[model samples]
Target chain A: MMSNTRTAIGVGAVALACILGSAQLVAAPKYEVVELAESGTIVGIVSFDGAAPAPQKITIPAGEDVCHSDPIVKEDVVVSADGKLRWAVVSLKKPAKGKAFPADDPEKPIVLDQVGCRFVPHVAVVPVGRTLRVLNSDGIQHNVHGKAKKNKPVNKSMPKQMKTLDLTFKRAERIPFVCDVHDWMKSWVIVSKHPYYAISAADGSFKLDQVPVGTHTVQLWHEKYGTLTQEVTVAAGKEARITFVVKPTEAAK
Target chain B: MTIQKHRIQLMAAIPAALLTITVLAVTVAAPGCATSTDSEPVADLSRAEALFVENCASCHGVSGDGRGPMASLLQVRPRNFSDEEFRYVSAPGGPPTQDDLVQTIRGGRTMGQMPAFPYLDHTDARLLADYVRKLRETGVAKMLVVEFADDDEIEPDEIAEIAEERVAPGDPVAIVGPSAEFRIDTERGRALYADNCSSCHGASGRGDGLDLPKDELGNPIEVRDITSGRFNGGAAPMEMFKRIRCGIPGTPMPEASALSNDEVWQLVHYVDLLAGN
Candidate 1:
């Protein structure tokens, strides 16, 4: 009888082990493997059509007690009426569908510092739920404020001390941030829900990576110029190029 | 009887162990699994106030009354927080629009005491601007009525023309701010500056580029010694941008009509870095 009891106990242990192993196997997540369909390159030049306009002369009205400096002219950086392109923001609007890229680690967050009264990057692309560390490296005091339609706006003073303002944007928005003390400071933070976005260079060039094989929409935005959208069909492992021309406003002509 | 008592104790301990395991699991998993309160969307006043005191109070006064210690020394008294009379407006007379405030903050009011706070990220500027409006409404409680003389009427187009005349002929490009390194190609920018600007601004951005003939007014116009860090105008990056974009009126400098804003901002960054170095 004692021998029989030992054999039964051994059998029960083996059955429990098999059940647990099966459970684990069944619970494992399944993901589809996607490959690039075709290899194509997308290349386009961004050009502005009109002649560069002359700078604008601005003077402090006689009564204003502001900077007593001489008359100042405004810079004309916006695209002219003749469709010139400079500093146009180009990015993929519709992301290719496939296995999502590994999410960013929250612990090792991206940083956008405000040292010496300026945003580190005029434009930044950050994933959702990622924390942005705004550091103050100036001896003088500065306020770091961000305005976003969907995300909560952050307005805080960055004293001479190196303080980090940790923030996260939950949605995608081309948010503009500035300091009240120093009026001219400005930067754009493009908080995206997905990771596929790029800012056009001063020469107006952009590239998007790891796009799954499919048709997607791309968007181009400029602070001064309006927004432009285009639909592109990207093959697997292939790059499809598209060009966008932004016309200057009538006054610029 | 002793065996029976021991068995009962063992059974009781099993239930207690299970309960302890459940509690431990809940404690460990709940914090990570629970939804965050940030999703609820609460206005964070403490954070906003902290930001205000750090950045705005220096010029706008600690109490949002436009009476900061710097206000007394500044030529254009920081906008009187209590007064709502704003001179810059896009619409004929709409309570200072958000865009107006933003544009003023971003581009900066030219030739005024207000310097561009480009260091403040765009979002930060918007938040602070909104908070300024809030403070104006709550702290000051009334917009200061600004009455303009009939002669003050200047058309936007006319203003644009005056702005154009401000550009200097051989002026260096405008740089955006201290942190504009990422936005600019410094190598290309340095070469451009050397080619177009080095003659007057000097190889090192010092004012001693080259002594040119006297202007029609007979003033010995020296290239702005940018590296010396002595700015007749404000030292803000935007201030430099404005100076580059629009030549300093009455100065020998001419506006840089060729460079784009991005290029100008890069130049501004280079100048700031060179001055600091």
Candidate 2:
């Protein structure tokens, strides 16, 4: 009788919570692993349509011998002479069912290293549940402060003697990291929920393979240009080609 | 029928009397560590919210955003509970433990701006700490929604889940003492300070070495003046040890991870001497 009374009292609050939860609160289907007979591919060129901005050099704090070895520059906008953009993240948006994330190998974990006071590979993608092994190769004092919203943020101290630290992200999001001592040091680790994600190369080309045959929304995101999406249909055993031409002015919008 | 009714009433009254005695007994026994279980969550937050508004909202703001009317008047600003990380956390990169929050509320910081509220009992302090924790969790959730507006959609449930996960405190950093054979050496500590900390903290330990450095929130922060003898973190030996070991979160202060235990002790001694302890 007491339990019944409690349930009756909670019903209204439960209803109100559900109402305020989301507009369309339908649960997304979980991804499944299956033997693939046929799969589709997505290939794209995330090119810059306008003249790429000149790379700006960041002034380093004086007195660090290792950091002073090389000049650090702003890596937000990396464009080749022919206007090919670099470091743009591209992914398929919310595929109901597709491929499973890659199996984790503890021996060969994904490494994010601090070399010469800069994060190598300004942008990296790690599958959820996989570990990111952070190394301080500079052998100097540094901290890896991950600014994560979905995952727990980590601000581990990497003193000169400490060589390696490992981190894992449970949720999918773009987490930026920085060093408190070195304010200019920054990097991004995109924890991917699915396998259909790729970072554009120096030639501005990216490819997502093993996608199920369907019309899927493709999202291209850059640190500066923001995000732009395009829809394309994928055919089984065949590749779908698309191009995302980003303009400098689109960042203003 | 009258006899049966009396028996039922007597049975109920016996239990009621026993419950009253138990409540009184517990209340009388409650003191420092007895009533303080920092890990336990409060069942109801209504009273806690009311308490926060009455005592803390003047400086911390009703929303805990650190923009209270008195915030601008204070030389050292009250911490924005929602937006900023707690400076005195023992868990590196994790949320503050309930004890950390409760102690800060009860004792306040050593700095003059945040005064101690000794009048509030331990239970009240715990309630306010729980409320402040909620504010931080809610704030992180809101921040996520805005940050990922362009990227992926985070549902309400996911937001709650993420916020809870992000704010969950981890194990406290281990505190160790100098080795048995180690001896205090202020001269070595002074040399270490010159090599490691002097660049930002100044040669004289006066916090005059560099221009105002930006914190994790990108806000310009004043470096702690060690010579002034007042530490935002407490001046106890262990407090100074933890501060150096973990470093202050969200600040430019780096942990003395490179230094050995002996070296840290030496530095601590040197700092104490500089502060005229």
Candidate 3:
């Protein structure tokens, strides 16, 4: 009887140890997965409350022609209908709850090109610490001049057939790109530290993904138009839709 | 009996240990401990004011008036701080446009009384320009005079003739020479320049043409102020002639290939008078 009792006790102890070991293994993996669920998505449209005006042309002085030929469409700057606020930059002023995306690499920068005296894209989304490649596709020589107040000013020549020139933005800036060879050519590149940003298209659509589920603020920015902010609550596994209306201010007019 | 008791104890402790571990992990991973540093305070006004006094007071006046002791001596008085009317502008009005102010301070108004403050560094120049605008707002000083001239409206010949009339024979080479024999049609040149040049270069050739745009980096590319004698690369008549014909490499000023060589010379001669040469 004594031997049987001792045997039973030893078996119970072994069983308990195995169960605890399995629990530890299961708990460790689930912990990391749960952290990911906290992240959510942010999406919305940035539309003009009133009439969107036709594109206007702005001329620079004779001596300072960085981008000469193309008519610069002031798209980023938008005016609200109320006409009070103007020239606002809408961005995620804070980081999200979880791990942030990796910082951009400066040595290998994303390139922005100018072909036929036109900036390739009307808008550019760049990560901070990453290099921006500027290419001149035209036969004529062009100067790639950047007007960033905080970052270094880039006024280098892009000679004909020049394949590429690399530039890095150290700080966040909405930099304007001009080609002195062609006056009307103009474009904007937005440098951001965080990856959770999207510029509204001409039709006014934007999307921000992988946001942690919870209450958060979404910011809307217009070049001429002021900014509008909205509070949103994101639920787990559901797509959240929000709309932001920006009124034009008198200053924008 | 002993075996049964020990089994019960292990079962109870397992749940409790797991709970404690999970709770601790969640607590450590929570984001509340991370503080946001985005709202850090900018430079204090006193520091900015001292910087302004040290660098800008020489030209923009200690009180933000265009009336520093250097103001009276400058050909175009430093922009009067009291007037609040900024003529050389790209944006119509909203705050003195950063581009105009930056360009004025960095590149200096070409041939104008304002000299480029490149020594201030771009960042410092920007901060100083911002401080100046604040001064304008606080009414520390106001622009007392507002002057506007149509450069295209006045011809070199007319200006030369006016200079001739103003300066008797050889009166120390006044801005306007007194040589009656050098008479040319000021009206025709004014019309031509107004129609062709004023769009990019302001009506007064002050580089403050209408609706100027900011550069990619948000810096203003100002029109060269031809009325003042300071030219960026060179001020010689031949240099002006070459620029008019070939155009400057990085600027908006285009080469007037459409105009004849002689016409470029006429433009150059007219530009010289506009420079007060």
Candidate 4:
């Protein structure tokens, strides 16, 4: 009775929230695992077709001798000369069915480091139910806060010591993290229930394997650019190749 | 919208909507640590103020200032909602974001004056959390955007661009508050604190030293006790360095221009000791 009423409120709030910045008020979906021996792969490259705008110059505010030993620029969009976009999140909007429970992938912990007061691996992907090891190596205090919609959010302070904050995500979502201490610092942590999610490389290429063969909604998200979605079909044991082109901030207008 | 954008909108809704009691019929929409962006769905605000006045007012005060009647008796004072700094905020190093306030309010701390209020039902607790967040957000907004005219307020698109110019890289920064950090023995730091800081910060690093300072409003500002565990300039070494090097504006805490990079680092160690870390 209680949860039923709550769902009603969530549903009612969704329309109002969408108007205010297209916020995702709809309760993010939960993850379920079922075994599937026959799986396919989704591989793609994220690139910008038009001219890449100059990087945003980020001010360190303080800690010049340490935080920004060198001039640091915000990586809102890291587009190389070859048109490859770095740090783009490529994920399935709503993953229906894919691989089974407890993927065979090595259970190595995903590492997120605060080196130079910045999140190393500016963009990363982790499977749901897995813990991400958040390390503070800069020997300076840094805080880790995630703005998550579907999964649980974390707001923890990492002491300068080699402390590891183990945070686990229970659902799938595209989460963005920031360091309140260093306002310029930002990163994205994308979570997926199955092995059908990947972050684009510095060269803008990404590959998602072990996906159940079917048509699925693929989405690309960038902190600077809003979001774009597409539908593609993955054949049995075949690699479905896709290309996503995002609008750079300057060109978007 | 992102969380930051919600801060602007929240300012308009919270104060006026204080008595509105916009309750969302939901029990606790969020399951685990799930959080949402701003543009929060409007809900009935109830027992929040009532619960606060009844249970929390003794320590948090009627207006949320750390000036409850029991405030003076306690070793660590209650939080001052109007103050700009809040150490336990959910946001990283900055002040507590709305969700942070909710979590902290729900799970009150063990060591300090904040006693966990498990008695408040999730719905009642959330109502109270929203009210507490409104107070903190109002205070932060006033402090951060005082210079801009009401009509000329900073917009979403302009923040990143403005930061580039106002907060240039490589420039010495003004310190704001404390955060968690690394530490070693404070023997040398203890000496440095004795020589430089103790006169104002107290021998034990509590802000109880002689010759206390005052803010611009002529209110007597107590010297910060490192042990109190709340900081105006975060607790991290760099945050401490930012404070030590640049110092707080319009206060008796002057910058340590003479101290070298290594010397300031040592001072941070000592201060942590005073905090009983």
Candidate 5:
């Protein structure tokens, strides 16, 4: 029992150390499949604490008619009429050894379609080892560029009507993707190591079900507001509720 | 004869089916090969935004509009980050990635108004990358793709005219003249440069950096001879500051992302001295 505790401490320390450093990637321990008698659910609401910043208007200054048809209103900070935030990502920073990503093949590809000079579904969740299928639905040219530190970066030109390009991330990462041709066409693909992640709905509510009962670090990430982290404990067969007050960091518009 | 015709038609469909299969195979295999770095740290946007104002605002403008106080007197126009399109990016023949921006920052454009910031730590460079992406996300800045009909087709005269008007198409910004108002401390500039730069750029600034690359036959490939000071980027003090901070891309010079902006300016002055300005 003492040896097992020490081994867990060793793994936890390594994971925490990787999380704290910027862009440092540590080898991850593979998730193991296990039978569990009791599991708890985590539910959360992520709300913006301040006034929503105005939508930025995207205009093509140089390649005018050849690019976008009209000025695109960026959905950076979309708040519902009822004050629910949309597209904010919530997930476990690092899960302890337990349920193996729920799905047998976490490697399934998540489709990201480019339509009307914009990315369909601005924020998408993809399990690590899963593929991100990027399809261009427009007739014009679009270049898919990825800005990531831990994963190999992607900058490929997608000729209109070409078959979809599959992007794979080896580690759990939140990658910001952009179309250089449109410039204003931007989105995110959050590649996770486990299934305990969800994007806040149009109503700003999110839940992570069947999480193994234990304490875990929860992280909330937003493109405009930045990130916030919290520690929550899970009881057997119980639900833990959380509310994240997201404030814009200096990166906020 | 009719039976032979029917069989011929059926055999002709095989290539079409095979073509579809080939496309499908290529399509299925492409995503498995897409480049996605998973080990990178999360972006720290706050830090990036702060640095952009302090280091990049003079040329890139506070709003990242590329209309800083010193707009003119430059041979190559400064990059307008707010524009969705960027000329220099990471992957071959596409828009710049975050790493491309980082590298662009590290290696100042060889023939543009941008400069190197080799002293910067990777963290700060990455933060700056995140900040730029924010501008893209918020739609404050947009870039236009400049699709040439064909590079070989454009005549030299047409190219020269556009080249002469390098800053012609950008959004209107106040054309404040050269504002490279750093107190030219040539003495300090010379000292700092002698220690760090002399080894690569050489004592006389002739670029006799001992290790010049040679062809298979052992002849030296061209290196920058700073005495002429004809950088692909401009020679403005601010431009020099950019080069110092970012370093010339595709060159031995590196970005000093860690260096203070003020220090970069001093090096710019020192480089001017080397150029006999």
Candidate 6:
């Protein structure tokens, strides 16, 4: 009888341990912070290969005074005059360990401003765990609706009276933000988990500094063309240059 | 000899009854102890699937993709679970809480487009909700795999791991109902509605507002005609309060975030008055 009791106690203990272990795993952090002795940089330019499509025109609603004043155009695919691709996010595909993200201050949080019924910057990069202040500079009733994959989606109305709303995401993913009132207003916010990421400038130039010294796979994602990857090798204290040529997708045409 | 036999019988019976009592105590207490753990109980997927097939498959699709045979006939398209799009979530945007799904299943939409399954026991409703969640998790995992197809670094296992973490629902938004002292002020509500809702819902709640409103999927959405006396969320004042506090997800309806709690109640009363409730 004593032996049977002991066996039951042992089984119950094991089951309890398993339950506790799984709960811990659910809350475990995906990325780890490590001190690096040496690191390199990856600089690249993203260019459009095909003939630029004509800018898509957006029809302004008749009575919205704030939206009617500005000429709104589709920003799904924006290219520079000299074939430089704009708004492509470039980053390392998988970085398990890296430098710590810069400390984020609540007072100076990353701003995703809504101006003239359009999200400014068209594409914004906000660090994971950092606060993103959604500003309604347009002074109109605009809702910031975020279709987030890895984070809790945000939907809140910012009327003319309400100026700002603050939010934060715990995971890294590209979230699409749109205004339902003005359906044409669209934007993307890339919540980056690591510092090894950059958005292409108007000149199509992008740089990822302090990437670990190794041959790492680089990823580029555009709103229209989807995700593309290429590999580049980096040496200690050196810079590796790579170029990504993007073409319009069938849907874009 | 008879006395000796009776004593022996009592001795055996006492031990047997004691054993039975011990077993019954352990059986009853085991489940109560398990609920104290932090981890949720493991969902019975097969049971959930069977329940979903029996009850929800007619409209929600056998695969939970919102493409059942009766889908085309419905005015409001049945929610596409695979797309991870839900309309009435307590939170602003949602991978809705399990409770949220259960509420919808039990209550259905007030408009009666989707019939209520009040006959199903609470346990069965929960199983169906879990099944819907499984469908969404699988769909999201597949989408990730496709989005990162070219990258050799992101394995299928890793994508699945990410999807599991990403699809965990956020906490339900807390709703505090109107206080006992509250009164329906339709006069104040009418003024508030004109300023806040008239642009989208029309001056008389006819839903012939500005331009056509479209959902996130770019599908043109017909605004709710409030005069019809049917609401997507529910007719209860408390339910209307929740809808006003947290906007309907996936649609163009914006939350009245700028309004005070009292003001929202006033607006709700005004809407009810408009619908002749």
DockQ metric for all predictions: 0.01, 0.12, 0.03, 0.02, 0.01, 0.13
Q: Which has the greatest TM-score?
A: 2
**Residue A24 C-alpha lDDT in model 5:** 18
lDDT of 4 at B233: 47
Q: Fnat of the models, one by one? A: 0.00, 0.12, 0.01, 0.01, 0.00, 0.17
lDDT of 3 by residue, B113-151 (tens): 666777777677666665555444223100000010111
Q: Mark the regions of model 1 whose C-alpha exceeds 4 Å error after superposition.
A: A1-44, A53-86, A96-109, A250-253, B1-277
lDDT of 4 by residue, B160-277 (tens): 1232221111232334333245345468788767656664576777676545355423456676778886665456676567566654432445445445466677787777666767
* Model 5 alpha-carbon miss at residue A229, Å: 2.1
Fraction of real interface contacts that model 1 preserves:
0.00
Q: B1-277 in candidate 6: lDDT tens per residue? A: 0001101222232222222111111112233233121223227645665677677867877656687778988987887776646677776456578888889998888664788889988998988776676666545544453454333233333544565565566567677766787887777899888767776788899888857787767788778788887887887887787777777776777767788888888988998987778
Consecutive 10-residue window with the lowest summed lDDT within model 4 chain A: A15-24
Candidate 2 local lDDT, A7-99, one digit each (tens): 332342232223224322544555556766778999988889898788889888676799988888888889978888999988987777788
| Per-residue lDDT of candidate 5, residues A1-253 (tens digit) | 3334234323432322222221112323455557778899899887766776666676544433434555567877887766678898888765655666545443655788887788878998877776778876665456566654334445554544455777787655567777643556789988776677899998899998888888987777777766567888999989999988776543332
Q: Tens digits of per-residue lDDT for model 2 on B1-277? A: 0001101222232222221111011112123212111233444555775687689878987667787779999998888866687788766554677877887899889885888888999899988887777666556654554454334434444654565566666567677788898787878888866666665678898987666587767888888788988898898888888787767776767555556777778888888887888
TM-score, candidate number 5: 0.44
The regions of model 2 sitting more than 4 angstroms off are A1-20, A23-27, B1-46, B153-155, B187-199, B202-204, B208-212, B254-267, B274-276
For model 2, give the RMSD to the true fold: 13.3
Candidate 4 residue runs with Cα over 4 Å from true position? A1-31, A56-71, A100-107, A147-153, A249-253, B1-21, B27-277
Let me know the DockQ for model 1.
Answer: 0.01
Q: Candidate 6 lDDT, tens digit per residue, A181-223?
A: 6777889988877777889998999999888888887888777
Q: What is the lDDT of residue B53 in candidate 4?
A: 67
Q: Per-residue CA lDDT of candidate 3, range A68-109, in tens?
A: 554555544543443222333344435434435555565655
What class would a CAPRI assessor give candidate 6's docking?
Answer: incorrect
TM per candidate: 0.37, 0.83, 0.44, 0.51, 0.44, 0.76
Per-residue error for B74 in candidate 4, Å, reads 26
